[model samples]
Target: MANNTTASAASASTALKARIYKAPEKAEISGRSIFLAGSIEMGAAEDWQTVMTNRIAHLPITILNPRRPDWNNSWKQSASDPQFREQVEWELDQQERCDVIAMYFDPNTKAPISLLELGLFAQTGRMVVCCPDGFYRKGNVELVCERAKVPLVQNLDQLIDKVIEKLTEEKA
Candidate 1:
């Protein structure tokens, strides 16, 4: 027989209103949480995090978004830069704390950091990656995901589905 517990968990998740926490502020993840780990090179990438937020807003979860609204493009990206260091540390900390890392590789942007994140978290089995066709390192992403047994999707829609799947599975 199918598990009644799984059905009840999925039903409960649907009633959840999502709470989002942007960077620099430490989030209190009381329950399920996901870190939006993706391409955020200001101009190079689109605000895909918003899309993820809108889609998953119904799920009872905390979204750890690193796209700071007050981001200053002129800040020096160096170890000596306090703001830069704070942002980096916040992202790292949130990713480590979250249950899931929803990562994306935008095709138009060369997301070197996203690739680095894939290497960092692929083996953790807490990642659901979306590397669409034309993304510069799709092949590399596929190989790592395949080996790590991570769920990899072809596009944003599928990525959302996979993330929801992971969240529901986590509930069980």
Candidate 2:
């Protein structure tokens, strides 16, 4: 009886919680997950990750957000840079593992990395992109999305709507 009680208590203590894991920080990922992959061009982009996380906090899922609060712009982009390499690797791993990838492109910023990610994952059928008007690469994004048959929207609100739809659709 004591052994049973102890095991139950331990399991409850370590039970998974709905949370957000920012860049370079990961965990033994469990349950439904969505990777927040989008425009984060050295703060040129808006803080969409926070908004997304807050909007979806009630869901039973983990949000893998790649916006690093302590990101140092001095770091080299090459794999030789430890921090940069780790952040890239973590984002890639989470994107691959996550059930869905929710991406956004802001018009005010030219997000090269976000463009690359969109290209890389467009055919995966796990991505939903929101590239609003005035974005530098809106045409390219739209054409690719059309060719790949990926879901594309015009704004953040639509992105949230689609994300919830996808997540709930999967659960059903």
* TM per prediction: 0.87, 0.87
Find the candidate with the highest TM-score and give its number: 1
Residue 97 displacement in candidate 1 (angstroms): 0.9
Q: What do the candidate models score in CA lDDT, each in turn?
A: 0.83, 0.81
Return the top candidate by lDDT.
1
RMSD of 2: 7.6
Candidate 1 per-residue C-alpha lDDT over 95-162 given as tens digits, one digit per residue, 9 for 90 to 100: 88899999998999888878888899888879999988999878999999999999988899999999
Per-residue CA lDDT of model 2 for 1-172, tens digit only, reads 0011211222344553356677777545656789999888865788887777666655667778888778999999999999889999999999889989999998989888889999899999989999999998899999999999999999999999999888778454
**Backbone atom clashes (below 3 Å) for every candidate:** 0, 0
Model 2, residue 137: distance off in Å is 0.9
Candidate 1 segments whose C-alpha is farther than 4 A from its true place: 1-16, 170-172
